[model samples]
Target: MGTSTAYGGPGGGTPLVPSWLGSDGDAGGLASPSAPPAGAPTKDPASPATLPPAPPTRLAIPTPADGSRFTAPRSNFTRFAGSGGSDRASLGRAVSGYVSKSSGGARQAAQRMGASRGSGARLLGFLTDVQARGATEALRSLDLEGLAGRPIDEVFMGLADYICPNAGTVDEGIAREAFIETIVDLSTLGVTDLDALSPDQMQTVFELYATHAIEARLCNDIGTKLVTAPTDPLIALRVQSQLRDFIRNGVSDALTAARAETPNLTQDRVHTFVDTIYERAFGILQTLGDAEADQ
Candidate 1:
């Protein structure tokens, strides 16, 4: 599939995801963005959806010492763009290791904060609900077959509530961003209509969402401010792009490995299944990271 640089960001138009993604639902505040009018036109094929950055508040991470901050051991990405040979391998290890560790820490922190459900868990819950009760019964007026008529983005916006519930936390925002990015990636693969999505395509969507969710969660935990941005604007963007691909590749591989054991999912086993995927994904990443470091 061809790639596009049309992703939404800081300077982009209105974000494709919900504006209230991280809102706490205060008395006078909105809990979600207003839906487009009933007859809104299908999304223009020529234009791609743009996703905004995650919420500004970051998950707290201890800063490394200034001297060691940019090295491969820490996964800061400072040396990743220009490195070669063993150096590139070391940088990859750092990226994988840092993401794996931060993902675990973020999960623990979310549990302690009473927001234990992440995007993958939430999405699994939705699937389980659909399984227990048919899609029409589960979603009331929106069956799986009905999705064929709507624009793909509209379907995504409607599904975001279930996939990335309003948690009022950085994690929720990261999850929301990941979900939007997944739609964009799907478009590249010619998945423009919701009803046309095949079984494998749907599985691919979930896989990619899990991949992006893991990477986005780790990046937010690491924080752009903590990682010293390259002085040149273009180099910084390139580094950011490369670093995302590197971390995403590791997570994607991990998920592929775990998918080998995927069972015929039941409502009762949904949570356990999603948890196992995450556990295995991180475990694989950590092992690969260690091997990379030792190389």
Candidate 2:
């Protein structure tokens, strides 16, 4: 009697296994010795309609645990000509020039106000005055009614394009460093009280510093670019508007972050803190502007 030819046997053309079973050995129970070998082309390739649906992709959202220090991605800005080397050097020069002049102005204002660099309270008061006067003068022309409902950061981000249209032209790294240095100088003026804040609150504070630093650097770059015609009233107003919006948004973002991190943080306390920081930054700019005019 001849051997049964139900499965592939000698001189049999039929495969021992079905072609639908994946050829990989790891196909688990679905795989069988009767399946065709892996990598073998199918006579009729599987159509998209026949394939199983792909699993959905999930997006990860950043949380407070991710840390509060957020740096903008470098790719967000355009690369400078000759790559980053020359661009960086140019940006460094601009930062150095602005910091030197602004620090001198701030020191002079501090002395005149009888507020030592270490006196946080007196310095805060002085900054408050400056901010009020600067903001009043800066926004006297523009209609700000539309901005009342927007998030502080969103408003500032929008003004970023108008205030410092050329900011994207500078190297992001150099601009970031300059901004960080400026924030440190503000700390020397006793603007921030680190001991009073919780760790999470401190993170929010640093995030605000980082945000404003970038904005200030952009303004500085804009000023440097306009050195030839600095007296243009229109240009000055535009820069002032940018600075004001930057301060406003920086304070708002810090408070918002603080609230998120510390649920117990009261809205009233956040408002007070935001007001203080915003005024202080605005005042500093006002003094800086005055010193520049005198020079």
Candidate 3:
């Protein structure tokens, strides 16, 4: 089959989307750019489906100072170029140009995808929904091929696996690993680039991961009042940053320390501001934990 596969002795095989690919939905405003709809690609005997995405030599990390800014940074490339990027071979470069290349790319994705299948988990479907939505957003903002120098599919697969390996199969631990990796990876993406992500693109990221923001409204009315209305609003600032850091680092350290504890630990002022997310996030966690225990 390897030697004869290229000969095309039989009539051209069916022209259809592969079974591995699914019909990704258009999430609200997110857009899904199908990988380059190339003439039915001739499969290499060695490489099925498509060649693997280029492995990154190094991860691309935005400067930490620049990371703190909420505005769109300078365009490393021109505006999103998915439509214009050449699909000649799929991605031109690899993951490095778009996101950081960590030590465990393939092994991690494979592990996540593999473990999910073994866990009798429903996490994959949920994550697939998430990825498709995120993919939609990322596609709209990115230069699909020029960024990769490959077909949009390569970009999609690269991003998809990176974001949710074994999206439809992984267990909780693998799912958690993949989720953390994705958020960390997205942090490197420019705000403009992230804001430009298609629905499918945004789907892979988190609901709370806002790329652009205004610092002035960092807190709501209640929060301002709770902090003695400090001009700096120190405590509220501390919590917000702690949550942000948790999202990035998975809560390794707590924001509140004995020495740093605020003198004013009273008043219901901040509760109004923090209650909404705290209630919801905690509720979801409690519910999920209960469900897992029951199972």
Candidate 4:
């Protein structure tokens, strides 16, 4: 593994892509633009990575003709992201479950966006569209490229500590404190009536949460607690309950749509998808549990 000059930077420690053309960002940040993940199955040529539609007549979200200003936070981000790991995973699952209920083009795009290789937040956003638009036109108004770092409270107020803060004198250290407050807010939201809204509507509720003033304040609170303790269990339970509630919503919606779209889609198949959503979440729930234990 001796790097002569080709891989070395100015002196020897620096390294650059073999070819010098564009950014090293494609297929998201998980893999090299030209390479797939190790041992990952190659996607079918027929189902290429191009903007493959989810349905023949799917209505897509209007993606920003250009990209959004949402760059993932730089530096100290590991601390911020790791602290919110449980929330990110749980939210991703909830969003994924809701979006997967559709049988049309929205479903395809949702699956693509929610792919394991994609960002947790991005997956949540695509899922948001499905919940907002319904299975039919869910994909019609997506602005995927425009939602980067939009804010966690956009979906979960407790997670607001993960959003844009008072872009003033606060540094990362102070912002992390603000994030702590967000955790409190998110904890409160998690405990709300999960059964009140349908799965799709519940996801919409999260979308609304992301925009409300309460979430912003939560972020401010977390920012005040910088290197604080992990979020509480009552909060964790609420988040978990929300996850299950979200799954219920998606399952119910999927069953309804399946009956209408492919008359052949059996109740059993719908159950299978619901189970899939639940199963995807088990790992996240475990992580949340562990975090609570540490507290």
- The model with the greatest TM-score is 1
User: lDDT tens string, model 4, 1-295?
Assistant: 0111112112111111111111111222244568654555555578866543333322333232111111111112223323444544434422322222211123231232111211223323434444455422432343232333334343333233323223232122222332343344544566333223355444344333222221122122222222232376454334433433443444334334533554343323433333333233332333342343344
**Residue 127, candidate 3: C-alpha displacement in angstroms:** 8.9
- Expressed as tens digits, the lDDT of each residue in 1-295 for candidate 1 is 0011222212112121223322121122222467443344446467776444334433334333233222333343434534422255655565564534433332332231112235666665554555555444555634445553566666666787766667455545666777788878877887766445554655677677767665554444332321344556566565656555655665566556655676456656655656566555656666665676667
Cα misplacement distance, residue 153 of candidate 2 (Å) = 27
Q: For residue 176, what is the lDDT in candidate 1?
A: 73
TM-score between candidate 1 and the true structure = 0.59
lDDT tens digits, residue span 60-148, model 3: 33222222221111121111112122221111111111111211222221221222222112222323332445434334443342333
Predicted structure 2, TM vs. truth: 0.24
Output the better candidate (1/4) by lDDT.
1
Error of 1 at 68 (Å): 11
Better of 3 and 4 by TM-score: 4
On a 0 to 100 scale, what is the lDDT of residue 26 in model 2? Answer: 13
How many steric overlaps does candidate 3 have? 47
C-alpha RMSD for every candidate? 15.1, 27.5, 26.1, 21.2
Off by over 4 Å in 4: 1-109, 113-230, 265-295
Q: Candidate 2's residue-wise lDDT over 12-105, tens digit each? A: 1212222321211111244357855554444536563444443443333312221111111111111111132223333333323322332233
Q: How does model 4 fare in lDDT? A: 0.31
lDDT for 240 (candidate 4): 33
